[model samples]
Target: MAEFTVNATRFDPYKNFKFRVKWDGKYVAGISKVTSLKRTTEVVKHRHGGDPSTSRKSPGRTEFEAVTLSRGVTHDVEFERWANKVWNYGSGLGAETSLKDFRKDIIIEVYNEAGQLAQAYKVFRCWVSEFESLPELDANANAVAIQTIKLENEGWERDYSVAEPTEPSFVEP
Candidate 1:
């Protein structure tokens, strides 16, 4: 008889609770949430002059809503730097609306426990719409400091390749 040895490994469902975010690949930061969607379609109808009115439909322009990404406030001045570069602080509409002030996209890469990419999404033509207000701080309260970043992007698409787990045998989250 020949002797054989065996190794046992446990397979657990993947977790996507933790994730990292990037701002046009320039700055990498922690992300809490990112949500946005295309504008709803408006229904239009056309009626005949004399007889009963016929039905007609038309689709409105494709518009994107503002996306909000919440995260723990960074200790550095990265936020300030980015805002200054993208948004005009001084008076004038020129600063607020300029092609030179917008970023190409914002990417979010979610990883598994093994540091493997679980899912990813890229938001295109993102520009800072709002910095969002900072939460109140109290000496007596015990809580983590968090802030949200609002970005208005034209559109977004998911990275299907990255969304699929790299591991050959892994459970979906």
Candidate 2:
């Protein structure tokens, strides 16, 4: 004889491809790939002469990796305009200044099978840091043109206020 075990709660799986990206309160298009949505923190250590063998470790500064957004080149010049908001040449045409109206926060959402928000990554004070220049073209070749832009953000955090994606379970066709 054998006993079966199963949790009463249901679960749903989410795919990475099914994600939505929003910036400056607007949805951006032409995106093909995303990378480096990870963060790291520094640690500090302290110890006393009479203390135990180990030292005390405390969390220090947190650093967020620069996010890279890859996409195919398009007719839209939104990316360049977005970068100008961060630091653009002054109208005087010499010095560069930050545009008060340009900087904005970004949010990326992942959706589950039910089309529900699974996870959200909120990037604070995000700005376009770098965008690759136009790529070279050949006389005879068959391929899609693609470009990648990198973003430098002050900080980012997973909105734990939101629930995690549902767990995977049996589903009927």
Candidate 3:
């Protein structure tokens, strides 16, 4: 077992802008934004016959929320390739969706301002539930073209093995 150490000098939290998403042991490029990871559990309310007028609450099934990832549209086909695993457009009647090797495990890594890996999360059994290849094109608009993918995952947990790194201090010359 690895010992955990605290970085006492880190007064501020990690910034959200320095992060990356990886799958298949490789990083996906140009990921501009990612939705927050969330989960909800249902509460089961039950009452006993002997109880006067109060009901008891118990934990029920927990469901993980879908995460959406957005990136600038480019020639990279990573988004479209993963989306096709769910449902292909022109592939035959019954062979549209590829059942085997469809779901994948992904990692979201957060980096500190100094470009050090601060934290990471492992998302399990993720598959693209929704995908947007291209946003509405407007020649008049100056915004960049963007593509998105909504990933439905079974669950996600923090990777505790990634210990907090000791922040570096620089002296001015």
Number of the predicted model whose lDDT against the real structure is largest: 3
Candidate 1 local lDDT, 40-146, one digit each (tens):
55666665678566766677567777777777777755555555556656748766545675565878777777777776777888767677546788999988787
Task: Using TM-score, rank the candidates from best to worst.
Answer: 3, 2, 1
lDDT of 2: 0.74
Better of 1 and 3 by TM-score: 3
Off by over 4 Å in 3: 1-3
Give stretches of model 2 more than 4 Å off: 1-13, 87-91, 136-141, 160-173
**Of candidates 3 and 2, the better by lDDT:** 3
Name the weakest run of 10 consecutive residues (lDDT summed) in model 1.
1-10
lDDT of 3 by residue, 112-135 (tens): 999999999999999999999999
Q: Best candidate per TM-score, number?
A: 3
RMSD of each: 9.4, 6.5, 1.2
lDDT of each: 0.66, 0.74, 0.95
lDDT of 2 by residue, 30-127 (tens): 77788868779999999989999998999999888888877778887777777666666664654465666556788988877667787788998777
TM-scores, all models, native as reference: 0.66, 0.75, 0.96
How well does candidate 2 score on lDDT at residue 91?
A: 46
At residue 131, candidate 2 shows an lDDT of 74
